[model samples]
Target: MNFTFEVLPEERIECLRESCNKLMAFQKSVASIRPELFDTMNFETRLLPSMEKAIHNYTVVVKNNDEIIGYVYSNISPKDTYSNEFATFFDVTSVNKPYVGCLSQFYIKEGFRKYRIGSRLFSMSLDWLKEFDEIEDIFIFVSNGNSNALEFYKRKGFNISHDILDGFITVLRN
Candidate 1:
């Protein structure tokens, strides 16, 4: 099936809310396998707020006709040096170049995993980041034990740049 992607508008609060709830539900199910894979309340209490603050966000949705099967949301900023997680990553590396993009979230429904939806989301996010002119590289974190995710990123030209105890950080320099 062919999927069309687009940016979500603010007026579509219902769509966003539904998608957010679905994403959280799916993540929670996955978190059960590795309870430590997620934080207890970060998504609803923190990240969602952060995402809301960045109104110029992107939500790439994969649709099979009229239904939305999956979606990915991302927020980018050069001033995102506030979080300890970002600080920890910066300490081990250097942003010697001009541009760096961070991916806040990338999610796909389980039934649609084989459709390259994740790749499309990643590509669209990176492409959108480039519109800033200063973003030449992209960075993201994946669970340490998510070997499938690790391998997917690797196949898409991302390299393991840093490894924390719980997860590994990967980057793609442009």
Candidate 2:
């Protein structure tokens, strides 16, 4: 299968709406710890606000011809940004740097999951995040029950830091 990867400009982030919504639904389906929490999560609630708050953003989309098959969203954000009204993502003070990098969101359509597309997307996102010298800590948050994603990040060099939201989310750190 011939697939193309493109870095989406912030102005065109809307191009990811459908894929983003589906990713949320997929997570909800796999969530056992608090699936209802995903009811408030979607392109608008989750990804949009994340993009707005991030200091720097990187989004890459994979296409099979014209259909978007996958996407990965990463960002550099203030370490304090992780501690907010929502459950504090991690101990902000633990990171000496003012900013941190996050592999914020990732998804590959069911049919495309076995194609190594995810590996490529992960690598691209991490490479972009690594470009920032100020970023010392990199994190990936996996919703509960998404063992495959948890293991993928682990194998790629992230370690399980802790769970938040009463075990609804697993925080992985590098």
Candidate 3:
């Protein structure tokens, strides 16, 4: 199927509610270790807070005709943001910049997989993240059991940085 990609502005993020929740459910369905962790994660708890804390945000939605089948959300935020109570996503001292970029959340519906729709979204998000001069590092976190996503980010040049939350998350960095 033909697909169109659009940049979803911060104010229009409401349209992502359904897709974002679907992404959390999809991650929970695939996670083998502590999949229950996703139970508390959804549009409100996850995406909304991230958007609020971020210094800059970029979201790309892929559409099939008028229906949005996939989206990627990214942001630039203080490096300290990763060191909160939940988990330390990376080594703080390792990054010299005060802020960092993250390809925060990405998802595509099942039927739309393998169409390179994800590749385009990935590129769009990565390019947006790289646009910020203060961003010293970029990260992508893949939940345990999502090898496809892990490999996808790896192919795109992000190395496996480390695991956090008892191996539930595999952090990738560029």
Best candidate (score: lDDT): 2
Q: Over all chains combined, what TM-score does candidate 1 have?
A: 0.72
TM-score of each: 0.72, 0.99, 0.98
Model 3 regions lying over 4 Å from their true place: none
- Residue 77 lDDT (model 1): 47
For model 2, give the 10-residue run with minimal summed lDDT.
78-87
The whole-model C-alpha lDDT of candidate 3 against the native structure comes to: 0.93
Winner of 2 and 3 under lDDT: 2
Per-candidate clash tally: 1, 0, 0
Q: Report the C-alpha displacement of residue 77, candidate 2, in angstroms.
A: 0.5
Q: Each model's C-alpha lDDT?
A: 0.60, 0.95, 0.93
TM-score of 2: 0.99
Q: Write the per-residue lDDT of candidate 1 for residues 118-155, one digit (tens) a residue.
A: 88888888778767655555676664445677687788
Which parts of model 2 have CA positions greater than 4 angstroms off? none
- Which of 1 and 2 is the better model by TM-score? 2
Error of 3 at 7 (Å): 0.4
Q: Which candidate do you rate higher for TM-score, 1 or 3? A: 3
